[model samples]
Target: MAAGRSLPCDDEFLCAICLDVLCQPASTPCGHNYCKACITGYWDSRGLAHCPICKEVFAGRPQLQVNTKFRDMLEHFKSMRAAAAADEIPVGPGEVPCDICVGPKLKAQKTCLACLASYCEGHLEPHLRVAGLRKHKLSEPVSNLEDRVCGRHDKMLELFCEPDQVCICFMCLKDDHVAHQAVPLEQAHREKTAELRAATSGLKMMEKVKSSSVKDIKGSMQRSKVESDSDVSSINAFFSALAASLKCRQAELIQAIQEKQEAAEAEAAGRVAVLEQEVAGLRRRRSKMEQLLQTKDHLRLLRRWPSLQMPAHSEDLFAPEPERLSDNGPQFYAGIVRDAVARMEKAVNNEMELLFHEVRLSGSCEALKHATAAEDPIEDLIFRSMPKPEEHLRMIQRQHAVDVRMSKCDFSPGFVVSEDGTRLSFLEDVRFCLPEVPNGESQPPVVLATEGYSSGRFYYEVQVRGLDNFWVGVVNPAVSKKGRWILASYMNSWGCFDASHLKKLSLKRKPEKVGVFVDCDTREVCFYDVDAKTLIYSIAGCRFNGESLVDFFTRLMTSDDSNHRPKLYPVFSIFGSHSSSELVITPVSPGP
Candidate 1:
């Protein structure tokens, strides 16, 4: 007996002799199924008839025939297994997935032009079987099906309106394009293919021009480098004969000229890099077009024609020339030599003290002006407000990083608060005893941060790892454990909502770390998905004025003043059904 494959196998589908899936299965009178050849060979070897499973001997040999019904069923099962295996591949990177698949979309094998949907082999079986779908054109998997559709009509662009010079749908023929001349998509594809040759030829020419431009830029850089190196060598020789002060000036001049040469060469190198990239891109596109042209299949050529990405190129295809290296080294050296001679003469006379001081301060004054501009309050504000994409959360953390500590109020037992007031967790099978609200005696599993915000902006992050359902937001600081507080609803989706107003922002994924940002000036309380660096929700025009002053305070610490500013303290807790209720006050930190 042979072993079955990795997939789960049923005894009914397996042949007793072969042990693998039944192939041309034949049933015996003793009610046992086996491969036709296996059963025939078994009886022939012993010259006797017997059931392989039950060992029941037969008097005479029976004629063998293929079980047509069972064979069909076996084939059907094999097909199903094959389909399942084909659909094992989900939508991975760079894979066009079947839009029809519900979950973990399967890799697409074909794209239907008429349906405008990609389909895996399993899902594509229906189109192969269905008579109506058989007529619809299908091509190799294409990602951009939307591009094949007519934007105006919202239908597959099957025709080209000659007058308007645009792709149009069948519906357009009886509507906007009723009076205009139109042709079949394939006809237009053939016409365009002829024109495509010219277009691709132009691309080749562009590629050549850009390549030449790159070569020219690199050549210029090489020449400039050689000239600059020679100049530097001459300066080194010249400066070796001068005095210490004169030598210092000579060194400065050499460094300046070398820096200038490097800048110019780097600019040329950068231009060459861009031109080379464009040239390579053009070659790839031209190669794809050439391959398409070689294919004799008109339908494939037509289908792929739309997918060919042809970037717009200006009539002047040449790359811009890099900035030329100016011959400033000789001029600068000459000026330095004249200044050195004049300086010695002036010091001997000692008559231009004020003028010397003015000359000394000229460069320093420009640098000081730049520093003053950078420190301008208005400029700083604008710069801070407009942070780069994905840097929004980090910028907020940097600017408004606040210290958060879990306040240990007199809320009985069952809940564990860390010594430093940074962590909060619940005991096994033990519920927390939190604040008793005004309306009801229901205690929420909530804890407040020690630090409170009354003015300006504040941001803090809470590590909610090991917990599923939780809420992290600003709450009114309570005066005591039994003081007044609003009971916010258990939110599965993260968002901002309050007593007077409500706004919800649905979260796409569960985040391990959650950041809370509060801006008093703008009156915005925003929640951030820290790892994703995305703003989960924000409530604008929010007035966070809590009545309870003692809701959060340093435990046994000295504070004689009872009067405190109306501030909202950061709060977090495990709401809804959760496996773990632990929460950690994460210190604000920058991302790698």
Candidate 2:
């Protein structure tokens, strides 16, 4: 092999007939080796037998035999080439190299703990071939096989101490592990395997939970984006409607002022036209007189004067007095605009105060709307007025169809109830009166709902029209209506709008209809802009202190009152000096 190192591999290993490495080398009598298949095919093609290398002729087909020694040498050469190529390969990252391999070590496949050595596939072949070597423990490749042996005892760690939870050698059993619980390494491994299987199952379950949580979060984000778009649309619609209203009012005012100016101008123009006709007649008479004077004809001048008699001079015709424009006219109209604007501004101020105070009232209403519209027997009309989608998820036990009527006792003179007792309108120049209170406190004008509730949930709607500022919601039944009192002022009373005390709802645009919902069990009350279909505010987690049992019993015993639980009555308030609009209690249809 050393003498043949300089020879070309193609010349030494390749068969001359096939021009490739010999598959099954065969020798001819001429001493040339060729592939058995290649030489047979060549001889058959020509129908003659001859040595390809020497070209020696044979009388008949010469017998060729396999060159066993040459074939063995070729196989040895192929194996040596492979081994040399493997030696040139370098170790890569995260790969355990064979400890026994010299120079560039090959990647290890397994480690023998008993032998305290790791080996590549090539080096580990003997362990597989020899029965005694196979008995040595083998595992997945590891970098430090020496760590498996005990450092103190210099022996294989064959026992597991349960008490100390450390691996120990057989000698450690008599020393440090004598009083500790110990188990065979194999037994401990089996126990640990069972524990790991259980842990893997738990990890799989946790992965599923995390996946579900991620899905829920994605769903929430998508829903939030949709809701945000809806809110923007609703707000834009509200402002557009408001602008239209203001423009309509502006046009009306301008038309009114123009009508008055046109009427005045018409009268003044009529008087001026009459005066001009009289002036023309006078001028014609004067011209005739001048012509007569120039002609020296006294008779013609006298005749023209008699025929075109000059009208008598009158102070009314000559003075031409016209209606004068009042200096305060612009100021008066401007005052009207200012007053209207002031009312609107006040309404906005009150709404802003409510919005800021009830910052926490906002929540998802889409779920509640669906529950009512799809599942509950409540009418979808109740939800139609909602400006935004409901996101507040809660179990609706039942829907209450509450019938509210205006109470005369709590009504003001300005507020006129409808003949059917379902509507309330404000009339101008009417002074609202409060019934005499048992206590010294004054009462503000407020209309109360005839019906009351002490427990459970109730919902209702109020249609607000022709008024910019109006309040609607529930209040305690015991709230005073004496001289003057603020809404939601008393600790027990609650209402949607309470500029004097607490605010329940903040509105961006004046809603035509408002919805009120109260959940006594949850101690929550919510108000909605019905037309916009959005939540204005919510009063949540309301708590009330009870007086003594005797006092509570005394109130409960009253003939008209069966339940002493604080009954909530629907209440309303309106601002502005005069308004024709009414705060009507609209009918609510049950959802199917």
Candidate 3:
């Protein structure tokens, strides 16, 4: 039998049940061998049985024996395989063969100290027995032999230091390390042996921890990749759906625009066809009439009688009737052609006009007229006199009052209600006072006053006979009329009322009830209602004083005060300085 091959044994040595190897040898009466306890157990359990291998009858349990020879053979083979594997420098299971030494050689036995090269036993003879290489030390093959180097310089290391637990060169000990502790290579080897044993005790624990960490990191990366892929898929799906919807909307818009354009074109074409048809009919009728006039009968009559009797002028011939070829002979063709052309032109103009209705030719014309009318005084005056829109006027007044109060009073400008609660401060210089009673002696006054002014226009109004009687005048600086009176107020401070304050009153008949008075002297202006003698309102800001009274009065009479009514004076004066005079009340007769 081949040394490596497994051979079949005789039936007496073979196991009967497995048919290949006998686990424990047993003998039967028939001289056949079976596994110990195999045939005996079969027969003993059943009380009667034939031999499993030879069919020999076995009425009782068979004897059994251990197969020591077969067990020894198996152990020997395993030992040989393990020895052979150990002898070889076994690389990693799937590692590629070294390119330099492509074939198997005797196991690497020696390494060059200088070149750091490994050599098999066959190649190591020169380094061992040769006279020049006899001093080189040889070592058993180690997987990490390449890592041994001088501890300090990291060069090829031959010497080991037990004291430092390191490998070193002789140069290291002789140099800066001369005084340090040192030991022989043999002592270093013994120390390394103990260290290796200690390291090996915890090797399995380190490997397990390293393996767990690697598995955890790999699992985390795999999960992250999966989540990233899922996110990409979701985003792609969303954009695809959005793009599809946008495409649908774009198609819808295109269809709508196409339909609208088609309708517009169709309408335009229809109008053009109608105009062309009318023109064509006119041309055909003109051609027919011209052909009739050129006939032989008509020409001979015209040649024979130069002064032929013409038709009398009638509405059909003279009036501007619809142009037809027969009415005025050849001359009527021109009119017919003109009328047709005019109608066509008008139709085209109407179509164009409808197409551009938003275009304002009148606005352009007005702009041009305004640009050219810059020097026109009347236009300027008209523009100036045009009443501001009510909303705009209110806004301007509000802003003006805020700006004035913020500038003058040094107090934050805001609206405030009067103490009496009858008026609101609409602006810094303007107030709105509502009438307390509709038919009372006096309408409410919207007062306008400035601080520290002694003599100026004290303009106000009084209600008399259901009309406003406006007055403007100035009183003495000391607030007493008996003192030297000064001209102060005018209706509007034009140049004519600069020197003297004048008082002039006017009855406005259009509203049937208002009277205005302008006083250049004392700078007082007031308004009154004709049916009542009570003051309605006043404004006192006129700076004029010592001006010609008559001229000031003329200008004040002509001044425009359409928007503002007079501010009223309170019946009772509440001055802390003087309390001597009693309030005076006088009734005046109503004017006719």
For each candidate in the order shown, give its overall lDDT on alpha carbons: 0.69, 0.67, 0.44
TM-score of each: 0.31, 0.41, 0.25
What is candidate 2's CA lDDT for residue 521? 56
Query: Best by lDDT, which number?
Result: 1
lDDT of 2 by residue, 481-580 (tens): 3111122212222234321234543346766666777776556777766666667777565531224445544655765543446777887766443456
Please identify which of the two predictions, 2 or 3, would achieve the higher TM-score against the true structure.
Answer: 2
RMSD of each: 44.1, 19.3, 33.7
lDDT by residue (1-592, candidate 3, tens digit) is 0121232323534466767656655556786666666766777776777876566675555455655676565455556655544645533543322212345534455566654556654455567668877676655554454577765676666566545656677778886557767666677778778989889866766666556645654665576578668977997898799689868975885586567667767876777797698669657756765665667796665664533333354233355744332223335545675787697676556445433442322232333234335343554453343332232222212221110001122222333334432222333443223322212343223222222123212222222121122112222333222212221111221111112233332323312222333343345544443343333334344433333447556656888533222222222111111112111112223222
Evaluated against the true structure, the overall lDDT of model 1 is 0.69
Q: How big is the positional error of residue 499 in model 3, measured in Å on the Cα after superposition?
A: 52
Instruction: Mark the 10 consecutive residues where model 1 has the least summed lDDT.
Output: 480-489
lDDT of 1 by residue, 1-592 (tens): 0011233456769987888999999889887788999999989898888887899987888888888899999998887677656546667899899888876677898999888899877678878889999999999999888888878778888899989999889898998989999999899999999899999998898677656655665666676678669977986776565567667876897798788789978977888898799789878889999999899999999998878955456333565764565656667767877888796765444324334434443432232233334233553353243334456666677667878888888333566788988877776676533333223445466667777776667788888766655556777654433222231324344434553444555567877787888776555777777888887766665544432223334411456323443567777665443425778898898765
Which candidate, 1 or 3, has the higher lDDT? 1
